[model samples]
Target: MTMSTKRPFTKDIILLDNVEEVTNKIIQKLQQDVLHNLKRLGAVVGTSGGIDSSVCLALTAKAFGPEKVLGIIMPEKDSNQDSEMLAKELAATFKVRTIKEDITSALAGFRCYERRDDAVRRVFPEYDPMTYKMKIGIKQTGLSNNLPPVFSLTIIDNKGNQEDKILPVKEYLAIVAASNFKQRSRMSMLYFHAEALHYAVVGTPNKHEQEQGFFVKYGDGGADVMPIGNLYKTQVYQLAKYLGVPKGIIERTPTTDTYSAEQTQEEFFFQLPYGLMDIYWYGFENGYSAEEVAGVMEESTDQVKALFSNFERKKRTTDYLRMSPVRDYYGS
Candidate 1:
């Protein structure tokens, strides 16, 4: 039997015909996968007060009773206050057992912010580590010119002034290495709870983040099971509505929530907005021509081509983040 690459498309974008059915399937499969396959008691999800985690928690609670699902809030110094508040609100609304594990101290112990600040200070001499929210992202200006995005620092001061500057290779690596500590720290906290309760760690990355390599390798991506891994950003919203996730969370804009400054997911990783990016990714993956996708996206052909190239490049570079541990001997 041959597989069909043809998918339901609207302007070259794939569409989900039935969201409720999709929700039911994911919940049922998650329950089965945990009980029969992993023999886990329930799920431990890091609730970030975002749609993805909120929806994932709701689905997990539905799979295993509310008592079995655990929602953890791992806030750091850089985390947005609204995100923490929303996380608490969602947990209370869902009636799930919740705990707070502040990773700020752990992050500090790891010199995560310290080293990242050192890198940023190199670029902005007057940068004060105490009053600044620093994040590193790919340089965006020249991507359309066929230049690969370079890792750079984005600093937001106490007054909300913003600065964007390219970092030296060594400084970029240092900043990223330190910043990754936040994700790893959060993962560690999640595992601490999951292991204590005999539950599986649930991941919240949607298809866009998962496929486009927007995750932090074994950090946010290191879940035992990903309930929404197959769902598009739009489809996740559908399920979110069906699952009765908190309205505020459902309506909130997608953000990295990893940085102190309020940074959007588009600014952090995906250059395009999730809605547009999702369709373009689906179109390109299904072998749709760049011109056709461009027409649908209402973008220039060159812009579409550039977006497609960036997607492929990121997917290729981040493939290692998705790989299983390497072995010298091949497995049968």
Candidate 2:
């Protein structure tokens, strides 16, 4: 809750001063959570070569030793090649065993592409899955605007020609439902490895994803332990550096990597860059006034207030993603 005096209310407000101390505490807790609490002998992590997963892999290696950790690199047809390359680098760097599972065929069996494309074709009749790569992104309305978020579907042809359309609700829901199979399938694969080896699954969602409902339920959201669930994205990068994660991965832009066409996490869901989002989120959560945050961020007070409102709306609407299954009993 303390802010650095050097620049009060600035981005420095969220900087982790004692990164080593913070990381060591996480390591200690992860050991206790997995070994003692879950009665697991080892850890299973699905590495995406992203900062969150890389950090989780490193922490698991430290907690259970490299020999006791298994990193599963699950890639589908739409995944970036860089994701696989970086994941392998991370495993080699951490000295952990890794298994590569290509889920493209599995997704094929589930008709993931078929179902998703069926919806896309409704919007663009000429859309051909084989000739076009597609992605969904929130229209950038600037975080300071009070307008509701709008989602658009974009398809890029082989020639790099792009076309975008305002996604209809029915098509949007159908597309999302199909895309969720990817996460849920990955979760199943992770649990399979975990159960087979008597290892607990370590989830990689950071605070933003976990809190803002940016994850799939029982999918990426399912895990025995989420070591960095409490850490902000900025803090996750801090741990990444202290833990010696690969520099290429450290510098790589955070992405969803769920679509065939490349898309960043910011464009897909979060509208602001992580650094600015982290600062605003910290200020909002800590009860700092919009006027104070605006002064530091160099934005109008109304804009800051609007961003805060948007944050509240997002949390309220996505609260279901953070819930336990309801079990109300009338008899009781």
Candidate 3:
């Protein structure tokens, strides 16, 4: 049987090149919305070290004073120094009140009786919480007489740890399990913090993720508000400049930090360059049919035709995910 594509669950996205003017306007509105709600409700943002969350934090703090915004960094035992460092830097630079919690202890507390090797399991395993990537280090196997390029980049899963690999939902049960555990941990962590301080749980997902149902249902997906939801990958970068977020944060690859600090979310999920996918989303969302979109961004005639074929092949799942649910039995 042919492989089945994952259905889209979010709104239909229309592609519009150079959407900066309109998108920026929406972002300003979102910024104001976040500001109005948080200050009035005594809400703070639970920030992670990732770009999306960091960007949201910057926007939120700008709207509300740094004193009013609370940022939290939740890193597990497997978290890297880069992730924690970024978190600490954000707190210091922005003067946002911060709480640091390492979730390894929480994991241990939950699995009080498990053997060291047996390891603990989580309820929500669909969400992998760590980002892992392979460092292109020392590729010279036998080059004593000649010099060679010192570094290159290639895909490595979960940085160096096998335990944190981001897995597809249809694939391995363990990765899916771990993803669920970490994802819920993140959601609950943010929500609990949100409630205690009267802050909103800010969502940090992207359009591609939103379209593909990449988030856990009601777990990571549930949020009080989203400051960065409407902004696509490129648009966020542009806004990041306007917000004064650190260049490092802006430069870092986009990843969930769910499996390991090295893995990127886009690389793990689509295994395709994010630039390509961004264009894909742009085309679909901007009212172009799959055929028409292929014409614009397709690299060559063969590529365009291939895209056409794929679009026709994936039409069902594509349409399903693009269009809003046709049948909703309950309104509430």
Candidate 4:
């Protein structure tokens, strides 16, 4: 796994040469962690019709029998219709049992939409939930620029007329706190099924999500075992293909799907496309110099360095998300 400075640094550097082996290793670890460690009868996965969840569901089915795996499709009012469709398709493909739990009512009860919209209206006085869709995304800070990321709020009216504004910190925090309810609600549903069925909840976060802190701490981040946590986004796609995931899902662009207005994972959080980000991240993690990466990426050295710096900043800031509860004093 030595990185050669003289040799070309291509995307191939991250490609898994032994896809089958990698898949089997994950299946084995999952079985061990769930059946032995967690003492669970089977595995429960929250499927979003996305690549990560699809691959997780497939691995769960393979690790335990298909009958032992339960795919819970949790959708809310803001969720994409295609997410449910693809999630169902994924379960069917693997012969895993699935149950749909629409959390729209639950979210309403929790005032999820109302609270989020209330914050949106603070920024856009004319915002009306009935007539408008809203989303928040990070403004591109230019990976090479070493600038703090800024978030922008967007409201789209019925006619697709759109307005954008810089999100004040207060509104941004309020909006995020409210939107997180969707994930927290979905997590509650997954745990209920897991407990009832005596199955362990399997997480679907990839290396980027886990390391870069793109996931909600106790929401999507709550799981007994994470099989793909170590694999990069590109590697997850590799596993999806190896596992025969549906073409539609494999080809689907990654999205936030948490917002009503359409937004991509890139625009919402990760600034660059997964392909470029993956390579740069790999270089950064493996101690590759900026000049070396720049030579390979054909970008300026300072630009590569800035991207690396950004990665470091994200990890540092999100480190708290990955920590266990602080317990300084135990009874002696």
- How many clashes in each candidate? 0, 0, 41, 0
What's model 1's lDDT at 321?
81
User: TM per model?
Assistant: 0.93, 0.96, 0.67, 0.97
Off by over 4 Å in 3: 1-40, 110-171, 289-292, 301-332
Q: What's the ranking of the predictions by lDDT, best on top?
A: 2, 4, 1, 3
Please report, in order, the local distance difference test score of every candidate based on alpha carbons.
0.84, 0.93, 0.56, 0.92
**lDDT at 42, model 2:** 93
How accurate locally is residue 292 in candidate 4, as Cα lDDT from 0 to 100?
83
Q: Candidate 4: which stretches are off by over 4 Å?
A: 1-8
Question: Can you write out model 3's per-residue Cα lDDT over 179-278, one digit (the tens) per residue?
Answer: 4565567678877877787766777676656655556555566676766676666666766666677878888887656543355664445434566666
Q: Which model is ahead, 1 or 2, in terms of lDDT?
A: 2
Q: Write the per-residue lDDT of candidate 1 for residues 1-332, one digit (tens) a residue.
A: 99977654565245567878888899899989998899999989999999999999999998998999999999988888888889989888889988889999999899888888877788888888778777767677644767777777888889989888878888888777888999898999999999999999999888888887878888998899999998888888888888888889988989887766677887877777778777888877878788877776678999888878877887898898888888868765
Off by over 4 Å in 2: 1-8, 330-332
TM-score of model 1 (CA atoms):
0.93
lDDT of 4 by residue, 183-211 (tens): 88988999999999999999989999999
- At residue 44, what lDDT does model 4 achieve? 93
lDDT of 2 by residue, 1-332 (tens): 98755455776888899999999899999889889988999999999999999999999999889999999999999999999999999999999999999999999999999999999999999999899999999987747687779899999999999999999999999999999999999999999999999999999999999888999999999999999999999999999999999999999999999988999999999999999889999998888889999998899999999999999988999999989898876665
Candidate 3 weakest lDDT stretch, 10 residues: 112-121
By lDDT, the better pick of 3 and 4 is: 4
Candidate achieving higher TM-score, 1 or 4: 4
